[model samples]
Target: MICPRCAASLTAKQRNGRMCAQCGKRFALDPAVHGKGMHDIRIRGIAERATDHGRLKITLTQLWYLSRSRNYAWAGRDPQGVPARIRWLVALPVAAALVACAVLTGGVLAVLAGAAACACVVVASSMRHRPGQSPHAQIIPAEQTFRDLMNGSWSAVYGGLPEGVVDDARPVPRPRGANRSGASVPVSPPKAAILCTDRVVALFLTANGIPARLEAVLVEVADADGTKGRPTVLAAALSAIAQYRSGLPVVVLHDADPQGALLAPLIRGAQPDRVVVDAGLPVSAARNRLGVVRLVRHDRLADAEQLRTVAGLPEADAEWLGEGFWSPLAAVTPRVLESIVVRAVERALAAPRPTHHEALTHGFLTWPQAPRSPRTSRAPGTRPPGTGTYKKKGTSSA
Candidate 1:
């Protein structure tokens, strides 16, 4: 294994886990934490996407699982055959209610009763509460947001990736009516970096939130061209370096794979002069912290070339990644992905507002300053009686 610190090869003769003969740095990946026992971890490598903590709106992946976990018309094509047990919980009751209503409540009442029972069953199925588990973090309805972000409209009939979804590769086409303004508007340079590892992710990120004619704050590195070390990445790398030189923070959103891990490093290599914080795939960072990678049976696994690319990872992590399967960055639902992007932007913007001098010397990040309106302040150019602001309506005091 090459030293992550020095990038030098290591001989396999060390007996102590702490010893590294090349760099001689004793970095222990795993450290025991005190729990009920001498506890090490609650989650070792990510379990095979196997149901962890969560609640509410789902990702495309989550929807796939939820569909498979039950047997119903809506359970999708569960080719794996949902366990019969799931039916007893929902379908069985609905069916029983239908039969009972047919016997007791003759007329349209029978159908209504059955429909009511089905609705109740659906609600019951969705109310997932288990001991020691937090409800899945609520997100803006994942399926809807993704659909809207992709097509810039939430009118999708279903919560799935639709064909011809607009993305970085396919931006919202300018309407024929858009030329009504006559002359073209000059394009503005992006103010911040929102790096995404894939085209879909970049499209979704750009498409999410208020639809704008132009996205001035978002500079995208939609690594859509597949290979990481391509001329496209070099273009993105150069742009990122340019942005870094201009004092804008680069926020990278990547998959939790070896290439994803390499993104920040690659950009950092592009501009060794400036500092760029890797707002990371924290799990990947966690893996680096412990020198381990979690293996999961993701519905989507990395292709052979991707797997081979990460194959040079340290033995333990490479084993975890190479265990015949892998997950995509899409494993992070659209909602969570949005939250991560927002936080990264917030962190960058939160850095002390640079002074004019700093703007000239260190370069400046452009951000609109917020208005400082006191709670009692009236709307600008509006003033009424007593308190130097508009008086409350229907109040005795002026």
Candidate 2:
């Protein structure tokens, strides 16, 4: 292969990480595509057509174990034997109900009637909660505005954290030891940093009524704080899990579309402790039910296709689609903004606004006028106590 940018011959690259030597620009190439030259005889076979051709395949034994032992279904295949699984599942309760009813009603007729009722309940519950039911078949429940604000829209709601999610943010306190004799010592107050994208997420916590006292506000503000530096804006959202009661309810409110689907999981993955209630439109009648609904965009939104795509999202993807969905250039329709405002106000009513009001107020971040003080002759990077930058009378001049 040749480097597209620099027109230099591309050499064999490392696993999954490709490079453009001459231009120093790198593009990830399919791992399967490497070493298999386009002109190679192997190119004439089925390998060229496979979507996963770049991925290496494991042994059949491993595949079987993943499928059966762990009860995992491999990608690209609908779950097999779902009907049988459902019927078998439905049968257990049906039989139990029939036996119980017979004893209660004192006859075979009673047993048959009870069996019918049990069958109905089993069928309804299984269909409602079954794993394999296509997402399209699911009905979304209405949401309340207050609930949406309190719980947050789906993509923003709390949920499970991936392993090592908060490892980087964990505070590492300095050790205690002897000091005056030139020995190690313990640090006071213990410094720690809570990484976040900006003050927005932190503010969101306060808006939802969580305290911002030193308790959760340690230090640092960034999108991420981890071994791998993926840019994001919700490092401390995990703390919201403890602030809000566990598993009360969470609604993911976000733009509906592909990007939204991908973003919601990132937030959910960071907080493994809380349960995400749902992802969907958070209008007042949508709470307590499946909360998946399309966001109402603002008027004259430039990206009609994007807006349309988001609004047209299927219901089953409420969770996957609601995470981190942001489009800066897109104009949200007035209707959408109104809906958002309504939901937010409703939620705010549910709980008193979280602590740290200054954080939520934008002007708090506006640069403060320099404190007035006398001029000093100190050189750059050196200033005596109480030296201020602003002008004041009766101070030494340079």
The candidate that achieves the highest lDDT relative to the unseen native structure: 1
- Runs of candidate 2 with Cα error greater than 4 angstroms are 1-231, 251-260, 266-326, 341-398
- Could you give candidate 1's per-residue lDDT for residues 1-398 as a string of tens digits? 44434555555464145345776654322112111111011111111122222312223333222222111111012234344456456676776767687679778887788777777667655554322321121222234433333233212312323232333333433332222222112245444555556545544443343112232244455555445443456476666447334565555666555555456655555554433444445332323322112233322233434434532234544543433222345544445555556645555554544333321111011112222223445568753321121222110110
TM-score for all models, in order of appearance: 0.36, 0.19
For the record, the alpha-carbon RMSD of candidate 1 to the native fold, in angstroms, is 28.5
Which regions of candidate 1 fall more than 4 Å away from where they truly are?
Answer: 1-190, 210-216, 225-235, 239-245, 273-275, 283-315, 322-325, 351-398
Q: Give the count of colliding residue pairs in each prediction.
A: 4, 43
Instruction: Judging by TM-score against the true structure, name the best candidate.
Output: 1
Backbone clashes (count) for model 1:
4
